[model samples]
Each structure stands twice: as C-alpha cells, then as structure tokens.
Target chain A: MDFGAMVDYLPLFEQAMWLTLRIGWIGILGSLVIGLVVAMITHYKIPVLYQISLFYIELYRNTPLLIQLFFMYFALPRVLGVGIDAEACGMLGLALLGGAYMAESFRSGLEAVEPIQTESALSLGMTKAQVMRYVVLPQAVSLSVQSFVANIIFLLKETSVFSAISLMDLMFVAKDLIGLYYNTTECLVLLVIFYLIIILPVSILGTVVERKLRYGAFGS
Target chain B: MELLGLDVLFKGSNAMRLLQGLGVAVEISIISVVISLVLGMLFGIFMTWKNPVARVISRIYLEIVRIMPQLVLLFIVFFGATRALGLNVSAELSSIIVFSFWGVGEMGDLVRGSLESIPVHQYESAAALGMTKGQIYYHVVIPQAVRRLIPMSINLVTRMIKTTSLILMIGVVEVMKVGQQIIEANRMVSPNAVFGIYGTILLLYFLVCWPISMLARHLEKKWSN
Candidate 1:
C-alpha cells in the first residue's frame, strides 16, 4: 500500500534476491549432480549402492525441507563438532532435498526409454555404456524435461525457507523489512513481485521447452 | 553416544508436548484438506465447464498458486492481511486459509483431470438413456472420477501435512516448533540432544508421511489395474 516504503526497501530486496539466486542456482546444480548419480545407481540397480540411494531418496523425499535445513543447520554441527555457516547449510539442505525429487524424476525418465530400444542397441553390437550414452540417456532426458523443470521450480521456491535458518534470502528480507518498518503490505507485495520475477521466466521457458520437445518427438 | 541424548525426550513432559504439536499439525492438515476437497470440487467443475472466463480465471489462480511459494502465501495471509485488510486472523486460521487456498488449486486440478478422464461416450450413453445433465454427472461421471481422485487426493493430503511444517515459521507451534523448543530447553543439559531431538522429529515426520505415501502408491497401483 505504501509505495514509498517499498521503493526505499528495494535495495535490500535486490540484495536478497541475488543471494537467493546464487544459493538456489548452486543448490540446484548440486542436486542435479547428486540426482544424476543416484538415478544412475538405481537405474543400473548397482549392488549395495542402489539400496543406499533408494533409502536416501525416500528419506529425503518424505520429509519437509524445513526440517532437513534445521537438522543440518542446528543439529549437525553439535553432533559433528564443526561449525557450518547458514548459507552453506541452506545450500546443502536444498541439494539434499532437491536431489531426492530430481532422482525420482530422472529415474522415471530413464525407465521411460523403451526396453526394445536398448535391446536393439545392444544387438547392434553397442556396449551397454555406449547404448546408455547414445540411445537411452538422450531420450530419457527429453522425456523427463518437464518433471525436471517442475522440480527446479519447486526447489527454488523452497529457498524461501532459508529465512528460518537466518539466511537473508528474499523472504528474510521481506520479513525483516516488515519487522523494522511495520509496512506489512508493502513488504509482502514486494515479496510476491520479486518471487514472480524469479519464477515466471523459468515457468514460461519450461512451457516453451515442453512444447518444443513434444513437437520434436511426436511430429505433432 | 547419540542415543544418550534421546534421554531428554523421556525427561519431564517433553514427549507429551511433541505429541500435542504433532496433533496440531495433523489437525491443521485435516481441516484444510476437508475444506479443499469441498471447495476444490466446485472449482474443478467450474474449470471444466465450457466457459472461457472460468477457464482463464482458474488457470490464473493455479499459476499464481504454483508460482508463489506457500511460505510467502502464509506470510501474506498471516502478516499482511492483518494490516491491510484489518482482519484479526489467528495464526492457525491464517494457516488453514492459506493451505486451503493451495489445496483448492491442487485438488481442483485433480478433479478436473479425473473428470476429463471419464470417457465421453459414458456421458453420451447416459444422455441417450434420458438422464438429465445432473443425473448424468451424478450417476455416471462423479463415481468414476472419485475413483481416480482418491489416490491423488491422498497424495495431496500427505503433501499438505508435510507443508504444515512451514506454519511453525509463523509461530503455530507445530511438531517442528515443539522440537526446536525442546532442543533449546535441553541445549545445556544435553548438548548432543540437538541431533537426537531433530533426528527424532525427522523420524516422526517419516513415520507420519511414509505410510501415507505408501498407501497412495498402493491405491494408485490398485486403481490403475
């Protein structure tokens, strides 16, 4: 409601947005790496590691990201006797939680590649690794693109919880501004706009990519 | 070594407080889920209606819900509304309002999907059999949609329950909040209690959510057949 207050706090929100993007991007990248490894392990059904990956996936997926962050930020240091900063804890927690959901998305995508395609590739004298590299993964990646986008958006939104861990992400800035100025409407309106700015482009791009993928694959 | 820290849970009435916290979380989830189901059913039906305005409105609602984080929505409703709208909404009430708002979007989509999935021929056949529009929907469409709706809605329930953890941020004293309180109180008496207490809370969430997810999977598999 107060335009002047919102304008005055724009700089703070900008800084918070940058922090959010920095941590969210790094966290998403970490999750992508971890997810790929877990997906591969489960896809190949590797001994011992497969079970561990499955447990990791389920344990992370079934719990809230807030708890995971709290445990990592508040509890892990006490147990491990090492100090982890709030930002590191936020990034790590995001990765751990995002990894599980991404793994599920990737695994499903990998599974969606037809068995017949793999069989033919194998019979064509392609090694398993070559078949996976050339034939299966490309198709699987395309199939899972939508879910991957969804997971990315989900994880990014989850960065909101970093405020709870005392990280000055966008949400934290909004809450802090509100606490300081009592401009609840202004702070919250800015919060919503900032989030939309961050999320809308990804969401729009995701739709475009999905349409292209569908058309490219189906000739529709 | 870490097991000793769990002794804090057994000391005094700490465990009871936790169960109470869990109850609050569950209570919030149940209330919102019920509200969402009823409201979402209507929203879903409206979405599927042959009205461009309705479709556009629902689409915008869904997109807004999807784009904004639930935490932000909670803050807006809990903090912003009290100031802007001059409404004296309690934390729990605001939480329910936000959750139900979110659930309606989700559950409405589910309803729309299930309703759309009902074959066109079934509606035609019912019409041919001299059934009124209401009768067609009641006798033919809803029954089939409910079947598909059940498993997905159950999954939504689990999602809602997990998301209720966010309410603790706004000071709802849910399970996570209670766990934090217990850890803070026992920080000195049991420094290691941090790990045990949070780990226990993690386990408690797992216990509450895993079975529900499993059941959703079970129903999905069963109904798919």
Candidate 2:
C-alpha cells in the first residue's frame, strides 16, 4: 500500500466525487420530473393509456442500467447518425432506469391516498386536472418523498456502473488510480471513504425526512 | 445493427446468444439466491434469538453489505479476491460470492421482518401445548413465516438477477455483455443500432423478471388470506 500516492490521488478523487454528485443530481431530478408526470398520467388511468405507462415503468425497471447506458452510448450513433458525449449518455441511462422506479413509487403513493379525498375535491367543482394538480400531485409527491430520496441514493450508488462506458465518475477515477499505482489496499480504502462521504449525508437526510413524515402522521 | 431484428433471436447462433445470456443470468441468480437464503435465515435467527455474539456479528455484516456499493464489491471480489487468494478464481464465481453476500444481508432483513412479525401469542400457545423450542420453530413458527418469506425472497431473486448484469463490468459475458460486443462489432455498419440491441436486451430482462414479480405479488395476496 503506497500511502503517499494514495494521498496524491486525493484531489483527483475529490474532483471525481464532485462530478459524480453533479451528474447524479441532474439525472435524479430529471428522472423524478419525468416519472411524476408519467405516474400522474397512469394513476388516473388517463382513458386508454394505462397500459402504456405500466409498460414503460416495467420495461425500464427490469433491465440493468448498464445495458441501457450501452444503448445510449453505442446504439444511438448509428440510428440517429449523431453521437452524444459520455456525460449526456450517462444522464440518459440513469434517468431511464431511475424514472421507472420513481413512477411506481409515485403511483403507489397516489393510489394510497383515499379515494374520498378525490371525490370531495371533485364535488368542490374542481376539474380533474385541477384536482390532480392541486390535490393529488402534492400529496403524492410529499407522501413519496422518503422513497424518492432513498431512490436517489440508490441511483447515486449505481452511477458507478456508468464508468464502464467511460463516464468520468468517481469509480472511474478510483479504477484509474488503482491501475496506475497498483496499490490496491490504499486505493480501495480511499475509494470506500470517498463513497461514504457522499452516501452518508444521503442516508442521514433520507432517515430524517422519513422520521419527520412519520411524526407528522402521528401528530395529525 | 441487424441484431435488433426479431429473427436474430430465432436464428440458431442468435438463439444461442439468448440461451447463453439466459443460462449465465439464471445460474448466477440461482446460485446466489440459494446461498443468500441460507445465510440470511441463519442471520435472521441469530438476530431474533437472545445471543450477544450473534447479535453484534449480524449487525456489522448487515451494515457493511448495505453500505458498500455493488460495483465496488464486485471489483474487490473479481480482482482483489483473486489477488488475495493467490488463485485463478474466474469473474463468474466471484460474482456469485459477491452477490451472495449482498443478497444474504437483504434476505436476512426480510427474514428478520417475517420473524418479528410472527406474533408473540403464537409462541406462547405452542409453549402451552407443551411443544419444545425446536418443535415450536418447525411446526408453529416457520410455517407462518414462510408465507411472508416466500414473496419477499422471490422479489429479491428478481433483483439479484437484474443486478447480475453488473457482472459484465468485470468481463462476465451475460446478456448485457454479449449485447455490447454485438453492437460494437456492428457499430460501423448500422450506427445507433446499439439502442435497439440494448432495448431488446432490456426486454429480455423484463421477460426473465416480470413473471417472477407477478408470482411474488400473487404469493403476497394468497398468503395474506
């Protein structure tokens, strides 16, 4: 274990961590927005589109993001005759996979809300769209906040997989440093701490939000 | 490029690719699941039982498995484990071990949930009936726990199967890995065909997982009765 070289790679690892966070948050938010929209569309059964939303969520959820990422990286070049950069490719992959899980979480939350609330809103002369926008989405989003956060953490951890197709994330940096220095012990130790530094806050934030939600439920 | 065509899956060679992918996926999933279930059950029992040593060990194992990312674990098991062991352990075997450790901790938590969910009254009734501890566990406790356990375990199995695609990172030629090679080799000819190839691969995973997921849901509903 070369403690000294590991020390030198500290800055590289730090930069990688920052990039990972930036790309991951972008992917997470993008997916959440898309997922919520699709979830709403499906939750109301939206006339004849129930199966489409159901199909979309299922298709994305079951596949590994690695293959999805590959599709974005390798497949698009020929079909569209345009190539995307690695960062964009990574975002697309993560969003596709993450969006699926989020839709389910949001849909379940929407379904979990009592039907009477929707009926009351309907009887109050609110249109379906208005009822959904004002009454349903807010409740579902809030109710699903914990699962959403946990899902984000899960996405963040999985971002490492993007390294395979040359996404310059933290794991890539870790792998590069290990290959360069051949100090497996020291490099991996830094990598683990590097992961913890990012993931720990996420874990804490998720728990606190969940606790708050639980407490609020009891108070009400 | 043409790999996305439906005929590719039916053609002998392409069919072989599909079967190979299916074989690796199921093999790794089954191997990991069996090991994980046994490991999980033991840890679950220890966690529920009043044993100090077992309690501490199980907690630590759970935290480590939960916190460590799957990719890093695979990296360690694939590259580092072989180095550490001084043996030529293949990536596939390493994947099984790594997934087993991960799967076991998750399964153990589910088992723990099922065990604790077994009401205290059930135990007391068994005791009143003059059943021994082992008898109570086998006759009264395990049967009820099995219902909850089955659904969650199956769900975990699907999860493990989907995740085994990650093993491709370490050069495991599962479905995803095979798809990558096909796309790369054909990239010059078809361009952007990787999407369709991957899309098909994604569908293949759904095919593998969806029925099991349905079965899990069915079990949950059935057992709830």
Best by TM-score: 1
- What TM-score does structure 1 among the candidates reach? 0.95
- Please list the residue runs of candidate 2 whose C-alpha ends up more than 4 Å from where it truly belongs after superposition: A119-146, A215-220, B1-12, B50-53, B122-140, B184-196
Best by lDDT: 1
Q: What TM-score is obtained for chain B in each of the predicted models?
A: 0.94, 0.90
Docking class for candidate 2 = medium
Task: Give per-residue CA lDDT, model 2, range B123-173, as digits (tens).
Answer: 999999999999999999999999989998998998898888888778878
**Native A-B interface contacts kept, per candidate:** 0.82, 0.61
CA shift of B146, model 1, Å: 2.9
Report how far off residue B224 is in candidate 1 (Å). Answer: 1.7
Q: Worst ten-residue run, lDDT, model 1 chain B?
A: B1-10
In model 2, what are the clashing residue pairs, if there are any?
A75-B192, A75-B194, A75-B195, A77-B192, A78-B191, A78-B192, A79-B191, A79-B192
Note the Cα lDDT for every prediction shown.
Answer: 0.90, 0.80
Least accurate stretch of 10 residues (summed lDDT) in model 2 chain B? Answer: B3-12
